[model samples]
Target: MLVPLPSPPPPASIRTQVEVPLALPDGSTTTARVVTFNGLVDGLEHLAFGLGRYAERHTAVGSSPATPVRLHSECLTGDVFGSQRCDCGAQLRESIVQLATEGGFLLYLRQEGRGIGLYAKLDTYVLQDVGLDTYEANVALGYAVDQRNYTVAAQMLLALGQPRVAMLTNNPDKVAQLRRLGIDVVTQVPTGLHVSDANVRYLAAKARHGDHTLDLAQLTGAGRARPRAAP
Candidate 1:
């Protein structure tokens, strides 16, 4: 049977441009100068899109048929404050270095707290502290387990006039979502870690229930193997 396709989401209505810089190897970073407003995209942010500037003078790198772009989600606790619970901070910084060297766009999506907002997400953390899994904690706070979406990134990529991309991700869902939405994903690059003591169970909950694709080898990290498989 042929299944009906999903309706395209509504376009975002608000936008603003801001510039940011990226740190390069050899100990320096290039500036974007002005943030290219991706206009407005939906799902993750109320008016979600992205902010980026040019690394090289050319917004779209020529010669390279498939441009490399890093779709980074905004993680307040980890990215900004250096929280050890997750690998977001490491992923973001590493991606910047790599992108700066290769000259690509870092589509920084402002999806804080896994789309649960800042305050409520903190409350979820409290619940997690009391032993509830990440998914359960989110449900307890009336939020979906993993609400981050990449459609906006796809649109932004299109707006940048690129035909295809080499995406950086560990979640298979990200790859599938981009492909299903008509974005060309030439390569899938893994970023960051699998689990930590601070986020071991949280990562397990994600891999099990949230349909995220992360392997245990990334998690076990040279420790005694668990008798069973990772969630």
Candidate 2:
């Protein structure tokens, strides 16, 4: 059975912030005002990276244009180890670049493996190797297809006084969930597709099972070679 989505959470408060210069994949550096929060509903140590003109946008909350934001879930393998099985790493990189240049917040949620945790994610990989798709593997292990909740994301936004936003993502769930949690998702901006030979099946599974906005023909068509796996 599916878990019920939590009601909109009470506004959280900013706990701390630090100026961190991040090095990107292309040898470019951008300064990020990384923020931590207090009173997030989940109580996980999720982070919010303020990039570009985030300070300016925060002050312009009630103005004509809404802030730009991306709710990125944690994926250790793809994000840290450069795994090619999914687009999480690519999306992270893309989000950093786009938000850094365009001004936004990257809400790094701590829902590893769709909220199942790191070990279960690895177990799912093993099940995938045996012909199970990502969702199937997750269910076979007695987990929901996806167990993430965006209540914390909304709280983070509200705490920052930026309730309205232009959400950047391909997953409709992110939009709907954020809206349900009381964030005004003014517009949905799709991320550029990062397809590769190794991620073809994984991306296809996301589209088929999760309704992520991904083009199947393009994924199945000619693509780049696989990225080198992490050591």
Candidate 3:
């Protein structure tokens, strides 16, 4: 269930903004401004990137609907070290390339391990190795399947002057949560990356229980199936 937060006192606010050169996968360089924010609740820092000259504008320009946005949570093992336990690193890289070309923002939230923290996530991994699925492992450990909340994400978007966006995600919960928090999600752009054998079942579990719109057969190359359309 998605619950709305009562526009709490800006959980996140920009601390500093700087322009930096971004290296693309095609060996080309693009300029983007990196905005760092301080979390009022957790006291942690979160980062967001504004691509192209639009960085100076802050909000989305033109009358062509909302701006493109990707709300990516922190995954140190998968994103930084490229762990195969999940497809996070691949999705992050894909989001970067897409955002760079399309001109949008990528909010890198500091909610590691779906908000369970790293140590507990590692324990869940051990439980997963013993035959439990990701959600089951979390439940067995007496935690919600997903402890992450999108309140901070919504506040960050509002702070960036982007109250609406064409969200880049496969999770319906994200759309619902954001909308509930007053962020209008105009459309959902799926991260249609294929899955590996190392995490096929993990992805399947998410699709089955997490309400993620994914075609496991297509992702795993088991068939030529299409993902379900967003609601």
Candidate 4:
């Protein structure tokens, strides 16, 4: 049985998609209110608490309900105010941009630092500095390497009438897990990483240990980064 996820406060509606101006370097931004679906169980408007509702958000944007969807875990530091520690912010930005063009839904699940939470994740950072890889860092902190659960994703997909998906990810585990849950995974939308000095180590660890299915050789074509080699 799935762990009973906590629900948001009684108000059925938790988001007000207000059009606020975002002060950007080049310009401002107009976006849907970013809600913590995992943080507040009932925060998502019309999203009834259910099996995969934790990390999934469904919206009926177009009159027709054939819009594609994206399943993204929570990366608080990156997804929220931009943080250069990882490529998460960039990937989140890219996903939003791409999804906007296609008119699809993005299920932003709250799996901060792959569900380890910021505080403990920071401790893991200390372990990383001491030569521990990302997974090892988590283990050092007495946590699973990847504490994320995709059952909520499956539940949300079914809820949004997206019983299928053309996933935007490089991780085969995500694809396999979703498939196992009976979500019709059409294909993968390889969202490449924007190589940066700060995130080089994080990205390298994914390829080396995290079992992510990104082709290192292909990444090299886009100018391979010399990340801090993990111990």
Best by lDDT: 2
TM-score of each: 0.75, 0.91, 0.87, 0.70
Residue clash pairs of candidate 2: none
Overlapping backbone residue pairs in candidate 1 total: 1
lDDT of each: 0.62, 0.83, 0.78, 0.59
Name every residue pair that clashes in candidate 3: none
Of candidates 4 and 1, the better by lDDT: 1
Q: Compared with the true structure, what per-residue lDDT tens digits does model 1 show for residues 80-106?
A: 787877667766767666665555667
Model 1 ranges off by over 4 Å: 1-28, 43-54, 59-64, 222-231
1-231: candidate 3 lDDT, tens digit per residue:
325566543556677888878775547677777887666455667778887545664543555667889999999998888788887887777777777777888889888878888999999999999999999998999888998888877877777777879999989888988887788899998986447767777789989999898875565663232332333
lDDT of 4 by residue, 62-101 (tens): 3333345566777777777777767777776665655655
What lDDT tens digits, residue by residue, belong to model 2 across residues 92-161? 9888988887788999999999889999999999999999999999999999999887888888888887
Candidate with better lDDT, 2 vs 4: 2
**TM-score of structure candidate 4:** 0.70
Task: Report the C-alpha displacement of residue 181, candidate 4, in angstroms.
Answer: 1.3
Clashing pairs in 4: 8-42, 52-152, 55-109
Worst 10 residues of 3 by lDDT: 222-231
